[model samples]
Target: MDGDRRIAAEIIEAVGGKENIVSAAHCATRLRIMVKDKEQIDQSKVEHIEKVKGAFFNSGQYQVILGTGTVNKIYEEVIKLGVESSSKGEQTKEAAKSGSVFQRAIRSFGDVFVPIIPALVATGLFMGVRGLVMQEKILSLFGITPDHVPDNFILFTQVLTDTAFIFLPALVAWSTFRVFGGSPIIGLVLGLMLVSPSLPNAWEVAGGQAEVIKFFGFIPVVGYQGSVLPAFIAGIVGAKLEQQIRKRVPDTFDLIVTPFLTLLVMIFLALFIIGPIFHSVEEVMLHATVAVLEWPFGISGFIIGFLNQMIVITGVHHVFNLLEIQLLEKFGNNPYNAIVTCSVAAQGGAALAVGLKTKSKKLKALALPSSLSALLGITEPAIFGVNLRYFKPFVMGLIGGGVGGFFASIFGLKGTGMAITVIPGTLLYLNGQIVLYLLVNLIAIAVAFILTWLFGFHDKMLKNQE
Candidate 1:
């Protein structure tokens, strides 16, 4: 058999074969398996598989890490190996993960925002290219001048870079409706209403170029272009309303009644209630995050960097997505991403130091690839499989991250976008800001690498650790 097949076969054997598997699914970085018997699993054998970076049980599922792009392939081979997929299985998997109300809520936010990141990233790259081509210094470096740039080309770049953010409410609402089990088409329509041209534009209103229309003498209303919270809340309410309406209306009228009722009720609530309320809520949140980011002399950066990876361990880091989106929506760039990147770089650095100094070949094998993975963008393999397993290296990485984040705050670094980070994250800094970005990562990585090398690991501890 080929590598995927071989890996699938081994996973099947290790997990007590297909007969014992209740169901199996794959996410971005892991193969999640629900088994009939946990005790039957030889987890050590699963971990030793060639591409699996780590293995663990969580949320009542056995999660095997195979990194992004590989998990799906391995999952396919596993399915072909007689562990069939079932709707019940998929349902059970989702149901199993619906932990507390807070967890489900946070996970919902993650699911909604994760789909939207690629668009933002593409937009950020377009902005980077635009900034690069129009820069006097960069153009002079290429023996070209700014006057050589065409007016139409700059306009074209604006379209590429601005469309996603301008219509962000539509995207967020569409995603929220999908998550909340509403008609996504209705969600899209509702989102569009929030940004309708008939209403005063949000940016114009902010800049005092337009005024909010007061309906019923007290309700202040303006377009919700580029808004986050309003759209998100609208999606949830609209979806829930649609579901409730569908149940009450006859099937004959359901198609017309459900959507009509959802839109009619949602449009009013969204414009007058949600828009007015949550927009202010979002502003409050924005101000609070600003306070933290601007906290005296980089103190906030140091604290966030030190504690961020520790937050990752608890798996609630998705909450930051809302804050980041708010920051970008208000400020046009994200300073939070810069500080977070330093923390991530530190993790990779600590893992690299451990890989270099460890005597055991297994330690060397696991540490090196996981370190590379952390540097590229994903850090679970590095955290769970290597650094956290060693303990001290994780602490050293945290300290390094803190130190780097302090510098990031001092430098006032901001990224063009979110999602991509560390090495691939260079795209976010390409708008005449790459140098400072590089310096932050270098400082974080160097600090973590040096600290871990000097005091973090020992070969003797390997005998006691998993």
Candidate 2:
């Protein structure tokens, strides 16, 4: 109790006292303070305070990472010290002030995709479990024959594994609409219209099993199944169109008129314009991604592995989502995840090394749990709360990720999924490649831990804080 107040007092003093604070709020792991002037905050002193894991300026706020439980307690102290508190919505606007335009756009892409990840991750796990249990060799080891398994059970597995992907467009569109401030339900319906049983299945049309519906002499139309870019485009257009329609329609007719015009226009654009144009573009992107990853001697993998964490720092990592989705769309498997898993695992290792080596009990507490989170495939806490706070460990992590990625490509490691990486991601490799997957992650974690322990970190780094 006393410790929280002392830390809170020091933090308030370090950031130029309560007079300079405009508003303050605490999230799960950090204290976000919007200040009147950035020059007043002491970066060094703020970081040097015990219980303060790290600090950085973001958006329009000075953010201090104080871990989870400690942050909530420290926040009470901060409020008690007479600092005004702000709502998360207001904090978001203030946060909007920090990142570059490019950074903001990239993060917007991330936001749209973030909500849809769980569905994809769950489906991937289901796919892996089915693959694991259905393998002939594995069944033999268990003294069970494939013939003994019920046929209906196989159909049930398909229901679990395929439903999410079959309706992927709806998920993508719904999320995108929400991100862009449109009615998510309308976006979902529009997306469903694109894949309506009325339209010819794209795969069947390609396989010559179904006929292509042409609107004019040149445009051929087919149902968008297992698609992404088209739905994303449709979502953006539909949302903006809906907003415009709402503005023009009078209040009396607004509710009915707005959605009717929006859907009517968007359905045509989704099928006629966005679908054909972006689908071709998606094909080109898919091919280009395959070519680069297949580049000689795994050079591309090494480069991506090394730069992945750097991209995260720039707040632009979400750009890779398209590529990942493209890989899954074309191949039914994603090799990119192999490279990403290495990158993410190395971050965990670097944080783990810091936790093991740092002498400060407070620093140790933050690093260890952050490391665990990173290992389980979430890197933000580890990166911001520990590794990046110490410069050399971050660089070492990147090196580790690069080396691991190189090996991943050399050994042809791939995953039967997207959106999940590192530990939870093991489900993707359960089919027949779990061994290789473990090896890739081991190399990543081991290299990072070794490098950071030997050269990247030391107890002296926290001696001042202690």
Candidate 3:
């Protein structure tokens, strides 16, 4: 397998050539590629390639699973092609190539970031849980106290969970430039433009608190740190520029001239023009969300809660994560985002109820652990293994989610930077008018359990599978 580069190349060629590859990136177990035309891609040929373990398509992406250690090398080779292919044939080879780089960088960053989710989630939940434990004096047995809460380990975990967001643009730029066929040094410069200290203050200027700042009394650009669209859009433009410059420059000058020109142009474009325009739009949107959430709590909570489950199912849940992070960083807290907790709880409760009601021992076994994991806010097992298998449980979970979400909305309950935890921890936001969030979560759990138990557990469909 180490000697076999042809397998990957053959698959790429079969898919329609380097040009057909609109973008290419890899995850831990899969190579995620987007191509210009589905019809031109030979699925059979891709599957038949040696060491190609599997092939499938989801969400417009062509996924090819390969053996270990092969994908990274293969991805590097693909990025080297420096050509873009598009469905309309409207985009340039550089643009097409850059598009792949941009998309794949997102995917690759996701690959790196996703593996840490469980630990990050666990740490986040533990923060809430730890607070609860201290509140209840539950840690007396371990000689723990309120002061003990801020230990080095806890501080370390806090940094770890936050590291992704704080350094996100750097990570994105590093991955993006690599995927787009540019030098990492250029990516570092691009990354700097986003995370620069000067930019955040520029937002204050944009909002009318201050005036623009100049570098060497000439350059002027707004801030874009922690902004997703700006650095990403800049990177796309930068990669294209790199491709164009690399092609025209003599081989001797290519090494020094190409990256220098790419970085110079990208920084100017990002700082002086595109970055500010895009960043301003996001700031406006943020203001809009802030104003909207100030409305009747019920409406905001209901919609957010309802859409949360749907978005996660579609694997666009990261968008929510991004939003939540942004809101917390800029505005202190987000009031309308209570569904993640309830949905996780509902999923678990529904699965547990099904487990209890099921006559099939196998289903009971499956549901038991899934429900427990779901309780811990890990719902993939529950969603895929049990709820998705038996339709009613999933529907019940959604219904419970919607109803609970509605109540949470009514209460105006919002989480204050606590990591997601079990069902009960999410109820921490309930106080007076917000108490409904707690009550509704319990009701949602009960409803999910009872309804799934009644209609789902003993269903003949699941029994037959067992």
Winner by lDDT: 1
Listed in order, each prediction's TM-score against the native is 0.93, 0.90, 0.62
- List ranges where model 3 is wrong by over 4 Å: 1-168, 178-185, 197-210, 214-220, 291-297, 334-337, 416-441, 463-466
Model 2 spans with C-alpha error above 4 angstroms: 5-13, 16-28, 31-36, 59-61, 68-90, 97-99, 358-362, 459-466
lDDT accuracy of residue 378 in candidate 1: 87
Over the stretch 67-145, how does candidate 3's per-residue lDDT look in tens digits?
A: 3466566655556555332331132222333434455444444433343345434434444444445553466667876
lDDT tens digits, residues 89-200, model 2?
Answer: 5786566656778766776688788778778778778878888988999899979899989889989997997777778888889988887889999999988988888999
Give one digit per residue, the lDDT tens place, for model 1 in 1-466: 9999999999999999888898888788888888878899997788778888788776567788888889889999999988866543364436546478776666677778888988988877776677667789888887879898778977888789789878999999998998888989999999999999999999999999999999999999999988999999999989999999898999999888888889999999999999999999999988999998999899988999899999987767888988987777777788888899989999999999999999878778889988899899788888887788779999999999999899999999888788778899888888888899999999999999999999999887777754
**Cα misplacement distance, residue 221 of candidate 1 (Å):** 0.6
**Candidate 3 deviation (Cα RMSD):** 9.7
User: Which parts of model 1 are misplaced by more than 4 Å?
Assistant: 1-10, 13-20, 36-45, 48-50, 68-73, 86-93, 141-149
What are the lDDT figures for the candidates, one per model? 0.87, 0.86, 0.63
- Model 2 lDDT, full chain set: 0.86
Better of 2 and 3 by TM-score: 2
Model 2: how far residue 149 lies from native, Å: 3.2
For TM-score, the strongest prediction is 1
Would you list the rank order by TM-score, best first? 1, 2, 3
The alpha-carbon RMSD values of the candidates against the true structure, listed in the order shown, are: 2.4, 2.8, 9.7
Residue 461's lDDT in candidate 2: 70
